[model samples]
Every structure is written in structure tokens, then in C-alpha cells.
Target: YNVTHVPYNGLAPALTGIRDGSVQACMLPYTALVKNLNGKDLRVLAVQSKARLPWLPDVPTTGQQGYPEMDGNDSFVNIAAPKGTPEAVIAKLEGALQKTMQDAGVRKKLEELEVQTMFMGSRETQKWLEDDVRKFSTIIRDAGLSTK
Candidate 1:
């Protein structure tokens, strides 16, 4: 099948196209586009997340769109410091992070933004990264996809 690839440098242009009906559809990160979905005469064909986001519970997931067990919302973020960062600095950073996570205002703001925070300390983050790399490598190999 032939397809058109109209690449926009960023989300702003793509969103403009969507809003102006210049494009029929495109796959976008849920949170980035959720604001547009509200109060617009738009229908979400499907969400990529395993489960619908709390803010958009009415939206069906890609799995529910008949692609069983599909995961379009697979993404992660990580925190890292320079190789020789002092332990004192690391401890300070961790303390700040923990305090932010515990703050009701911060938590409420994040939730309102529809972002699910997965806060992990350095060691746990390292382990999670290793596990994810292994898992993703296996998936890529099994799917016959490669960077090269």
C-alpha cells in the first residue's frame, strides 16, 4: 500500500493541520492532543494506551479498537547525572524529588495535566532501564525491526 508522509517539524504544525482539517488523521501522544479533543467536534478513533486515561475515560484504547493487546502508549523518561557527580549532590536531588512527589499541589497539577508520574530513585531507575532495554530488544528482534 502507498502512503503519504507529510512530516511537520513539530506538534504545533501537525495540530494546526488537524484543527483546520488539512489532514484526516495522525497518531499523536495522548496528553499532547487531549486538550484539542475536548469541546471540539472531534472523535478519537482510538487511544494508544493499554487503558483509557482517567481524564479521557470515554476514549477506547487501541486494543479495544480490535488490535488485541496493542500498546501505543509505550514510553518512559529517565533522570541522570554526570558520571562523577558527588554523592551529596545526588542525595540533595533525590530529596527534592521525593519532596515534590509528596507535595499535594504538585501531584494535583500533574494529574490535572493527565501525566502519570513514575518516580524512581537512581538505583531503581537503573534496574528499570536495564529491564526495559532487554525487553525492548527482544520485542524489536521478534518484530524484525532494526536501527541499522
Candidate 2:
């Protein structure tokens, strides 16, 4: 498919483009699409995560839709401190975040926003970042997109 990459200034314009039929589809964040999902105007074709989202139970993942390469394309929230931050500070932050994520109210709110929260400690997060860099860097190199 000759997909056109339309660059909008922000979410409002992009959403407007979708709402008024200026665009057929878009890759928007789950949080951004939650409220719009109420009407029949918009639909979620496939989630980019490796597994299907609990909030979108009926929808399939990109991998299931025959695009396994897109499975790693996930929107995530991370809390990072400056470099050389004390290990105790990192541990405390991680513990608090883990606890907050496990809270019923917080979990419910995130779920309502179609965001599935997964807590990854610093080590795991670092591994994920490194892996993501390797993955996307290869794609960029293959596509000949240079930093210049």
C-alpha cells in the first residue's frame, strides 16, 4: 500500500482529519483514542503491542494481523531520573511506582484510558531501551533515514 505520511501539527488536527474523513486511519495512542471510541466513527484495527490489550478484547494484535514486526511498537510511560542519581533514590522511586501501579484506583483509571501499565525495574527498563534502540536503529538504517 502507498501509505501517505500526513504530518499534523498536533493531535487535534490529526483527530479532526480522521473525524471528517480527511484520513482513513491513523496510529494514535490508546489514551488519545479512548474517548473517541464511544461513537461508531472510529475503530481500532489492530494493536501494536505484542499481545492483545485487555481493554480492546475483541481487537487483534498487529502480530496476529500478520505484521509481527510491528509488535514491538508500543507506547510506554517511564520515570527516569538524572544520571548519577543514587541507587537508593532509584529503588525508592521504583518501589513507589510499583505500588502505585498496583493500586486498584490507579489501575482502574489507566485501564479506563486503555493504558495497560506494566512495571519494569531499572535493569529491565534499561534492557528494553537498549533492545528498542537496536530494533528501530536497524529499521532506520534500512530505510536510509540519516540523522544528518
Candidate 3:
């Protein structure tokens, strides 16, 4: 199928376009669509994950919907510091972030917002970041997209 891609500056405007009927559909993080889902303004066709999201249990995963290739595109939220930041400082921040993610209040708020929290140590996060870069770069190259 030939798909025409219309670029939006950000998720907010893209979602607004969908709400106003200017855009027919969009692919966005579940957290960004939580309010619209609660308000019944949008319907989630499928999630691009191997398994269904805990918060949106009723929504089927892309794999479950017969699109296995769409899976493994999970969006993640990460906190980063400068490239030359000290290892000790990075470890301290990672520890604090892990603690925050484990906190009842923080967990509850994230759950309410439909954000899946995956707290990883600095080493794991660095590896994941490298893997994501390589994966996305390959995807872009395969699709003939220009980084410029």
C-alpha cells in the first residue's frame, strides 16, 4: 500500500488533528492517548508490543491482531546526562530513578497515566540505547529515509 505521511510538529497537534477530523489516524504512545481513550474520543486498534499493556488490557497487541512485525516498537522514557558525566553521578541518578519508580505514589501516578515504567541500571540502559539506535538506523535506511 502507498501511504502518504503527513508530519506534525508534535504529538499534541497530531492528536488534535485526529480529534478535529483533519487526520484520520495516528500512531502514538499509549500514555499520550490515555485521556482520549478515557473520553472515548479515539479507539486504539492495536498496540505495537509483544503483549498487551496492563493498563489497557482490553486492547490487543499488534501481534495478536495479525501484525507480528509491528511488535517490539515499545516507546521508552529515559533520563540522560551529558556525555562526559561522571560514572558515580550517573549511578546515583539511576539509583534515585529506580527508587522513584518503585515508590507507591509514583507507581500509582504512572499507572493512571498509562505509562509503563521499566527501570533499568545505567549499563542496561546504555546497551538498550545503543541497540535502539542501530535498530532505528537500519529501519530508516531500509525505508530510504534521509536523516538530514
Candidate 4:
């Protein structure tokens, strides 16, 4: 499949372009599209995630359209400190994160994206990242792919 990639400076411009019909189409994370979706001026052709998003139950996933292996469901925002940051600093950051996640508004917005705000401490986050690296590494090797 061939596609054209249009790079926008930020979400505002990209969204404006979509709203004004400057671009024929664009793809973005579903959560990013949620607040504006109900307006009806824009339409969601397909979701990139494996399952249909709760906020957009009517839309089909890319996998459902035919590519069953296409499963890019989730996005994450992580907080990381410098390599030698002290434990107290990490604890403070984690505490703040936990508090933010507890907010009803934030939690509602996150659920719309189908994102579960994970407040894994640095250690657990590191372990998860490491495991992901190994898992993707194996997949890339099997597919004969490389960043290079």
C-alpha cells in the first residue's frame, strides 16, 4: 500500500486542516479524535486498534477490515527521570501521577481512549519496557526487519 504522509506542526494545525478540508484524510489516535467526533463534520473510516473503541463502537478496526495482524491498540505517556535520580524524587513523581489519575475528568478522558493510566513505579516501568524491547526484538528478527 502506498500512502502520502503530511506532517503538521502540531495537533491544532492538523485538526484545522481536517476541518477545513485542506487535506483529503489523516490518521490520528482515536482519543485525539473523540472530542470533535460528535460534530459530524468529520468521519472515522477505521480505527488502528485491534478492537473497536468504546467511544466509537460503530467504526471498524483495521484488522476487521481484513488485516487481522494489525494490532496497535494502545498509547502510553511515561514519566522518566535522570539515570541517578534519588528514590525520594521518584516517589514524589509517582505520588503526583497517582493523584492525577484519580481525577474523575482525567479518568473519563482516558477511558474514552481505551487507555488505562498505569502508575507503575520506575522499577516496574523499566521491567515492562525491557520486556517489550525483547518481545519486539524477537518479532523483528522473525520478520527480517531492522531499524537500520
Best by TM-score: 3
- Which candidate, 3 or 4, has the higher TM-score? 3
lDDT of 1 by residue, 6-122 (tens): 667688888888778888887777666756775774567877767776777887888987865455454555668998999899989988988988899999998888777657888
Candidate 1 minimal-lDDT segment of 10 residues:
68-77
Clashing pairs in 3: none
The digit string of per-residue lDDT tens for model 4 on 1-148 reads: 5545568887889999989988888877655766677556678888776678766789888788996544553555777889888889889989998899889999998786667565677778898688767766876687667645
- Write down the TM-score for model 1: 0.66
Among all windows of 10 consecutive residues in model 4, the one with the lowest summed lDDT is 67-76
Q: Which candidate is the best by lDDT?
A: 2
**TM-score of candidate 3 against the unseen true structure:** 0.86
Backbone clash tally for model 3? 0
Judge candidate 1 against the unseen true structure and give its global Cα lDDT, from 0 to 1.
0.74
Which residue ranges in model 1 land beyond 4 Å of their true spot? Answer: 1-3, 38-41, 68-80, 83-88, 123-148
TM-score (all chains, Cα) for each model:
0.66, 0.85, 0.86, 0.62
Runs in model 3 deviating more than 4 A are none
Tens-digit lDDT string for candidate 3 (4-92):
66788899899999899987888998778877884499998888887898877888998998867668788888788999999999989
Model 2 Cα lDDT, one tens digit per residue, 9-113: 888899999999999989888777777884566888998998888778898999998989779688888889999999999999999999998999999887776
lDDT of all predictions: 0.74, 0.86, 0.83, 0.75
User: What is residue 85's positional error in candidate 4, in angstroms?
Assistant: 1.2
> How high is the lDDT of residue 3 in model 2?
69
